[model samples]
Target chain A: MRTIAFAVALALAAGLPAAAFAQDEGPSTAEVDAVIEAAFPGLDEEWAARLAPDETMEQCNASANVPSDAVFEEIRARAAGTIVYPDDGVLVGSWENGEKLAQSGYGMRFSDYPPRRENGGNCYACHQLTPQEVSYGTLGPSLMGYGKLRDYSEEAVKAAYEKVYNPHMAFPCSMMPRFGTNGVLTIDQIKDIVALLMDPASPVNR
Target chain B: MQKLMTRKISTVALAGALAAGLALAAAAPPAGAQTDEETQRGLERFRQMLREDPWANPALLDADRGELLWTTAAGPKNATLEDCDLGLGPGVVDGAFAQLPRYFEDAGRVMDVETRILWCMQELQGVDVAAYVKRPHPSGGQPVKDVGAIATWVANRSEGEPFAPVLDDAAGRATVAMGEALFNRRSGPFDFSCATCHSASGQRIRLQELPHLSQPEEAQVAIAEWPAYRVSSTHVMTMQHRMYDCYWQMRMPQLEMGSEASVALIAYLVDKAAGGEIAAPGIKR
Candidate 1:
């Protein structure tokens, strides 16, 4: 039986197109989806929804995070539509609160269910925000002296808010979470993070 | 996030204490102002020190326990796992782990180390697989599960042996193909696949370097280290547990223990890690 299986595998490999060996020939999307669903048997409807990729995520996955130009524009536009600015039209909040939020890496995890406190932007996890924080990730670019580097411009501040609100709006397929659009952070919370990046008084600008 | 939170708090406290101590001693640059290179060098030194003293790894204790479990009889059949086949023939163990996640003819599927062990326990010892699968992983500072311990022991036996998974059969190829697709398939709230964090080299999440698993060199080095002793959790974590935890962190629902998806991911990793030397029970920060 093992010999037969090996012979068949060899024949399959020899006869099939190169694409067959590529990701295209792997389990079908429906099959992979079924496997994911089966892996988490007792998940609630809300949580189960997360297992299924959103339309943008599907495009990103299909393209290996490099969607076609048309699809890219579609994702960016869709993401832009999800951004909800605060009623006050003020993009920046207290730098102090922003600093605190940047420092906290809490919420959205399974253990953070029935959250005891607010969700954090977890900025330091992927970016160098403040010079004082030596231990920061290098996934994203350093944001040190962010506002100061940009001369604390109003345009920079608004841009910071939009990026945080939905990173895909600015750069589609960015690894950063969609904090505001995904409901991981409140509109006010996003304002605070914008303050962290664009507030002249914030340590990031120091 | 809880882990990251704890780390953040401790880091702040450590920086403050260092600042005070340095002020009393002599002038210093600033508190927590060490450059990224300096931090990376410090962590590398710490890891090197740990590696130099192989006996210092706490995962060995779990491996010792696993050895005991392997020899003892306890299940309904009251049979030891001596007769178990781990891709090698029954009762064979030496260098067995390095070539696993292979196609098992009897099982008619591809299974990684932990899944294969579960199969053995059920078939040979009449163990209740469901009950075993449902057992929760140990919390912080607690000991790993018996299966995890067992996997550590088995994998340790293959230490220094190069990974040589033979995915030449139809089942093996199919499983690995699924694994490759899954690794890049983005899902969940954060739009993350395993590739999101790991596809790129030299990237990090809070000072933790993300390995580009798509690259053979990085994949080999990374995969070779598991069943590792996680310093934060203070326990030996098996590959299955690692998958479960990662999915949890990705905000996805729990990945069932020894599930096909879990096995496929491992198979994919093992294939990527081919020719990489086994360094089981390696220390992790």
Candidate 2:
């Protein structure tokens, strides 16, 4: 066991890809799950469920976020099914409210428990939505002139709504959160974010 | 030399300006745009200035307190940790921090600095280990616990030493493997693994850069700076606290302090950070 472990470490140190490590050599999935369970003792059911991986998360973890073609399609389909459109069929809402949601990263964290206010898209955390927001992060691509570049068509508006709702619907293994599907953002909030992206009057197009 | 001094002075002035700009940016909504490159450069310069001035770091006060805790006899057995073995026989502290998270024969498990310290506190001083484990990390403006302070002082002793943790033993290797697995495994409501934010190079969460832990160059710099003084929180954060907080932010359940899982992750990180210089109790934003 010592020799094998040493060899595994040696292989890892020799520039072998992490994905190449033999799955059996590492702690089994059950072992890791047990560790996680024991780590967070006495957590309520709601928070406990958050710790366990959903089917989509399990698949993502199993493949290290690089799913096979079949699994990728399945994840996308599952994500698409979870998207709930607004009752009024309005894909766009007030961009002003959307701007606040994008700017505020105020939901779902442990400190945010017994939430004081509505959830946010936390859009600026990843994307550059407006040219004036210099403090934006570079995790996602710049969305400056998003609607303007797309000509603010009806199709563009609907597509923006879907992307904000569940980025996995279009791009599996996307780094963006599943805002609408995961209940981090409501349908109306998602619409507002879409407006922030696709509204002609929004600063993003300016 | 004169030109260099002039340039440094100008850079300091620029950093101050950018800091003020950042404060205003935080207070108001989007207005005038500063390019990402410029903002990052200014932040880096600010960090460098803080690092250069050792006196500016508030963590040193905690390190002094830790030294006091280490020498003074207090617990039930009325023992000082002066004779505690940190993988270098009893009473040896210099350079020990850089070579830790290794397999300990006596304990029969791989232990990091904090875990080993807790063990000694239990055995030598007859302190209740469970109590320390159960205590919550101090919030902003609050001092770190005794263990954290001691960890800071211990880590500070290894300043400028290269990290050379030898994970050649069977237990050590297994722990590293477990850590590697845990780092990559995506769980939780956000579907995040450590890899989610960390595997990629040059990624950020709202202007804060995330290191690519899998890559050695990035891993080295990242791990070497731990037991850092967080400017945002106004406190010295130990590695254990850092791990616990990351789990919290990931929306995972609380990661119990000194758990086997936490040890494994640190072991993996230390292994990856081999040869990185220890600059513990380092300052950070």
Where is model 2 chain B poorest over a 10-residue stretch in terms of lDDT? B3-12
Question: Judged by DockQ cut-offs, is candidate 1 incorrect, acceptable, medium or high?
Answer: acceptable
The lDDT values for all models are 0.84, 0.84
Cα lDDT tens digits, model 1, A1-206, are 99988977996877654444564467777778887887888878888888888888888877777888999999999999998988888999988898889888888878888999998888888899988887788888999999999998989888899999889988988888888877888988888888888887888987
lDDT of 2 by residue, A73-167 (tens): 99999989988888889999989999999999887888888899998878898788988787787878999999999999999998889888888
Q: Against the true two-chain complex, what DockQ does each candidate achieve?
A: 0.46, 0.43
The interface RMSD values of the models, given in order, are 2.4, 2.4
Which digits, one per residue and each the tens of the lDDT, describe model 2 over residues B1-285?
Answer: 474355455546655765796798688645335576675776577678767875445676677788889999979999999989998989999989989998888898899999999999999999999877887478887988899999988999999999999687778888898899888877676667788788789988878988999888999899997898886786889999999989877777778888888998999999999999888888777
